[model samples]
Target: MYEQISHSLLNDILNRIKPDIYQKDLRHFYTRLGANFYAIHGLFAKLYGNREDFDLQAQRLVETMARQYIKREDELKQLDIERERDYNWFLNQKWVGMALYANGFADDLKDMQSHLSYFQELGVNMVHIMPIMECPEGQSDGGYAVSNFREIDNRVGSLEDLRSLSEEMRSRDMLLAMDVVLNHTSDEHEWAEKARTGDSTYLEYYYTFESRNIPDMFEQSMLEVFPETAPGNFTWDEKIQRWVMTVFNNYQWDLNYNNPAVFIEMLDVILYWANQGADILRLDAVAFLWKKLGSTCQNEHEAHLILQLLKDCCQVTAPGVLFIAEAIVAPSEVTKYFGEDAVIAKECEIAYNATFMALLWDAVATKNANLLNQGIKSLPNKLERATWLNYVRCHDDIGLGFDDKDIIQSGYEPQSHRRFLIDYLTGRFENSFARGLPFAENIKTGDSRISGSLASLVGLQYAIETGDVDAQENSVKLILLLHSMILSFGGIPLLYYGDEIGTLNDDTYLDDPDKMDDNRWVHRPNIDWGKAEKRHTPCTVEYDIFNGLKKMITIRKEINVFSDFNNRELVDVGNPNLFVFNRFNPQKFHDRVLVVTNFNDQPQKLDLEDVASWGTYKQGQLFDLHTRQKPEIFNNTLVIPSFSFYWLREM
Candidate 1:
């Protein structure tokens, strides 16, 4: 990798390194830098070489890494060495995560530490504290509109509070994940303020233009992210007297990665948080990183290059830290977030499994696994080193992001199926159990998303409201069914904050003027400690879901096959209501686990001979790993109960 020109330039850059950085013990830093600098130099050159100051930018990037390495604490530095030796440590199945707001989960960062026992009780080891960074005073896109990248929001806690929380979580072997708004920032940010005052250097930080001539062209292919609220991609900034590309909303201006300085500055921001003890940084809105004309300005090739460069730089500084690409695109394009590598993820170590998530919802609406099986079979295989962040719900709307061709192949027209799902989930369809709400509904395009908490969307809320015991039990089974899928579907299962106790949608958002327009806030609930205490009671809904998921998580961690390493195989069981997949222990061939889920309200039967025909379970007595009991079989057929799944293995 040490080409003559690049390494010669790197030698000069290393020689120019500050004496303070050189005086420190940079043995591991230098070794990693030397190994990664060639790729770093190439990516930086590819991004900024035509500029006259490319060499200067290269020098700046190196020094940035050196300075950050010096700032990295001694304990974190030692942890980096340990992780580099155990490079695939993140892919372990023992890692279970939950996404929550610090204020929602507890009171703030200081209070979050006191509630660590709550997560431990639920078998969660990684806690993704959603977007606590400083944001604007009013309606801050639920904390997504980050105003200060390096400071925690005053409402949440002080920086010292967060550091203390991270330290405590590390002591307990728990991972701390925080958000970094990579694509855009609040209009009130310091950089945006400078741009408004007509500072050319700061203006270059964003995609601002004097006229709409270029923006109109860009608009021809760009799609509206928030079609109801923000109808266009570019917004007219009165203060700057210019149009800036605001992909998400008018108040959130997109950063221009075309500027190499922006890249280095963001890298510095990233390492700053890494030094704050964030184990994983979720890169928000990563799909919209690189914008281009005559295209959707998403999933561009240069975007991959930008991620690769960022990851390389991150490796040089904090090798232990990981990245979760929040690119909620289609299955065909989503895997690219992991980079174009067979065995290495040069872009990101993890990505959101949007397709899998959307498909699971479709199965919930239709009570069949035909589309779920078809959609998963069509999902492209991810890289060996990269894995997925599988979840039933999060702090967002459900987009039904499955491919149209998969719908057609599953015997349904694409648009009609989508409408049917929306109607059914929203309770507009006949006898629907869900109480979902509509979001971003568009009349012109007939496109919309559904928003509700997991409980509401799956009938727990409606069942409890109507006081139906059978229906309520069914809802509990469905809730556990969904969690079981994510827990065993070959990746880290990220349970949303309130889902552990079947927390229903919070309609109180309708009273808040700032949040009323956004129905997604209905699902971002405030954790109810009073109701959460019900989990300790045996006959409560909270008890069933919390205990069920805790058992599934414990079983998942005990099984080596659940560690994602390209070892899963989708099994076609010849029954439309059943979804079957096999997970094989990479270390032992005989230790295979067969997972079967039934998505019907009535019992479904799949013949044992057909499943064993593949020689997978031919030689063993089947036992449910979660239940520790043999599966019920009759006449050579296995019976899978309604709204239930089994992690079965040979006893």
Candidate 2:
């Protein structure tokens, strides 16, 4: 790692390190800086070496880490040592996660502190507070267009409230996950504001150009993320008489990582959050970090180098703090976010399993597991140290970004199959009970994503509305079936805020002019405490889902085989209605659990002859872990009912 050119540059930067950096105890700083400087310098050079002020930028980078380290709490420093000792602690099976907006889940960060008991009741030990950073009230982009990296949004309470919440979570043995929007900044952000006011230095912080010539070249290969709503990738700034790259929205200006000053500033923002007691920092839009002409401007090679350098620098300052790469790209590229190393997760310790989420939804709409089995089999294996953030739903629209080969292998034409899924989930297909909406519809490509709450998409909304008891019960089964897969799937299962109690889509967003444009807001609703109270009332719909998920989480934490160790085996049962897999402890093969899911409306039998190698006390002895009861078995075969799943263990 110690290359002469990079080391010599690092040596020059270390020479400029303020005397104050050495005034305190920095033995650990010197050790880590020396260990990581090679990669850091290499990545920094690759990103911004051509700039005239490269030497000055490198000096500021060293100073930034030194200053942050000095301000870091002693208790946190001790935590870093403890985590360094137990490097594999994050890969544990017990770490079940739940993602929620601070305001949606509770009133604010302070109120969220009081709701710790609710999280504990659901057996959640990792909570991701989605984008609490300060942003323009109406142009927030769900808090992604951060106006200030150091401040928590006023709507979500103050920074003190966030710190208190993090402390409370830490005391409860839970991890606090926060977001740092690394790719873009709100135009209202101080730097962007100054750039708008004719500050050339501040303009360098973003991708700004005086003319459309270069923008036209970049737009040739860059895909518009919001083609229908936002239109183009570049937005003309009349004030500055220039064009700025606005990949997400016109108000959200993309930062230029090619500028070392931008890199150093973002690094400081990252360390600032780490000091705020965030155990895990989710890096947003990391795939689009480094942009290049004549390319899609995603998953760039320099992007990976930037992440590697960030990981290395974080290890020096806050070793306990982790990074979750929020890259929802193809299966072939998703694993690279975990890094290319055989053992070490050089880029990120965690990433969203968007593929698994999409594949699960495919199974739900089709009432079959043919695609789920085929898709997962094609999913690339993760690195030894990295883990997945598996979830049934999140605060975004669902894209059916499955590989074409996998679609064909599952006996469906790629384009037609995708169109069928969109139609089915949006209730355009016959007998489809889903009440979802279309998102990001592109007329040119005939492609679009779906947006709806988990309960609504699974027919619970339609069932309850029509007063059909049988359909309602089937909806509940479908909800639990989806949860079972994520729970036992090889990673930390992330539950969305309202999914546990079957919260329906909130159509109120259509009334709010600020939110009416985005359909994803339908699924991101405020928690109704009055309706949530019904979970304690037993016979209600809320009680069924709440209790079912509560029971499943409790059992999941107790199973060690559910850990993310690549110990899962996909079982081809030869029945399209059934999706099967096994989770076993390789060290002790006898400690195993067989997961079987029946997606059809009719009873589906699993032939015992095919899985005889699993060994069993016949079908009668098989018990469902979620329901805690023996299922019906006849002629050495087990029968799973309509829209149901079972985590069977021989008792």
Candidate 1 lDDT over residue span 1-651, tens digit each: 447778999999888887888898888888999899889988988889899998889999999998998999999998998999999999999999999999988989999999999999989999999999999998789998989999999999999999999999999999999999999999999999999999999999999988999999999999999989989999999988899999998899999999999999999999999999999999999889999999999999998999999999999999999999999999999999999888899999999998999999999989999999999999999899999999999998999888889999999999999999999889889989899998999988788899999999999888989999988999899999989899888888999999999999899999999899999999998899999999999999999999998899999999989999988989888898999999996678778889999999999987877775334333237889988888887766788999998888877
* Each model's lDDT: 0.92, 0.90
Model 2 over residues 162-218: C-alpha lDDT tens digits?
A: 888888888889999999999999999999999999888999899989899999999
Instruction: Give the Cα RMSD of candidate 2.
Output: 1.5
lDDT value for model 2: 0.90
Cα misplacement distance, residue 195 of candidate 2 (Å): 1.1
Best by TM-score: 1
Best model per lDDT: 1
Worst 10 residues of 2 by lDDT: 612-621
